[model samples]
Target: MRILLVDDHAIVRTGLRKLLAMVSNAEILEAKTGRESLAIAKAQPLDMIILDLNLPELGGLELLSRLRQFGPAPILVLSMHSEPIYVTRALEAGAQGYMSKNASPDELLTAIRQVSGGGRYIEQEIAQALILQSAVPAASLAQLAPRDLEILRHLAAGRSLSEIAEALGLGYKTIANNCSLIKTKLGVTKTADLLRLALEAGVS
Candidate 1:
């Protein structure tokens, strides 16, 4: 099996590499950035992609959408984010499976096997959360795209618009426009309200 591992952390990639060795004769490829992973996926034939949500240049959900455009390999999101919102968005973006980093190695292997076999998998706890979330009112936060959510998270972390633009590799005007759009979507008129919404959603 040829599996591409996408993560920015070297230590995490090293650990995942060792864990993936359990797959018989598995050939693992590594990428430390979203751009690098997208290039690899476009250039190489891969059986599966194990992706992390936190990435440079591109957010994980956006990367998954682009990968689905041409890359046929099934994507399994292996992320530190275990929130139902994150999980639901990833699956909506084309991930075949979603597993938290806190999952046991055994569960990780199980997710890999299930996804590689053309089946879907979600961490048990996340699946339950999704079910519960469906029983309640869907927040406007759920309407935001992955990048928008990322921007909101940065805002909630106390980043200025310029700082967010630099961190996201975008222009200041673009960030400002996005903030305007986000405000419209959430029915807020001030940055403070956006921050409050982000905090309430646990996006930070």
Candidate 2:
């Protein structure tokens, strides 16, 4: 099997290459950013992709969407954040599997094989959490107001507050006030933290 690994950290790529070496006869290709990964993917045939969610240039999720435009190769999201929300969003965005960086070697191997073989893979704990969340009635979207929801969604998509305000035709102070209300309702301390939580929850 051939796999492409995309991450900004060379150490992570090296470590994953070593681990993968122990289990399968896989040909590995590495790229340090989303643009490089896309270039490599377009130039070569790959059975699967191991992608890190937090990237320097284009984010893993955005890259996943772009990759889907070209082909249907299974993507296994390897993220440091284990929140079920993030896992769910990746899957929703066309990822075949979601696994954390903290996973054991065996777990990583299993996920790679599972995804490469056309199967879905998610950690058991995350799966259970998703199930529980599904059972609960989702909060009404009206609670936050449409404008606030729009700002939150842009934030979830990695837009800065200034960018969000400009995009939405709102004043900076107005957007900032809406953001404060969002934080109060969501119980988030900072905008970045709130965005992370929103991503994990698949809000956008």
Highest-scoring model, lDDT: 1
Candidate 1: tens digits of C-alpha lDDT, residues 1-204: 899999999999999999888665799899999899888888879999999988888888888899887667999999988877778788988999999999999999999999999999998987887787642223768789888988887787788999999988999999999999999999999998888766655566
Native-to-model Cα distance after best TM-score fit, residue 136 in candidate 1, in Å: 5.8
RMSD of each: 1.6, 6.7
Model 1 scores worst on lDDT over the 10 consecutive residues at 131-140
Query: On residues 1-204, what C-alpha lDDT tens digit does candidate 2 reach at each position?
Result: 788999999999999999989887789999998889999889877888999977655666677878777677899999886655456557877999988887787888898889999999997666776777742213423245435545766787778878977766668898898898888887777878777655545566
Given candidate 1, what's the lDDT at residue 22? Answer: 68
TM-score of each: 0.93, 0.70
Task: Tell me which residue pairs clash in candidate 2.
Answer: 85-200, 86-200
lDDT of 2 at 130: 71
Best by TM-score: 1
Number of colliding residue pairs in model 2: 2
**Per-residue lDDT for 35 in model 2?**
87
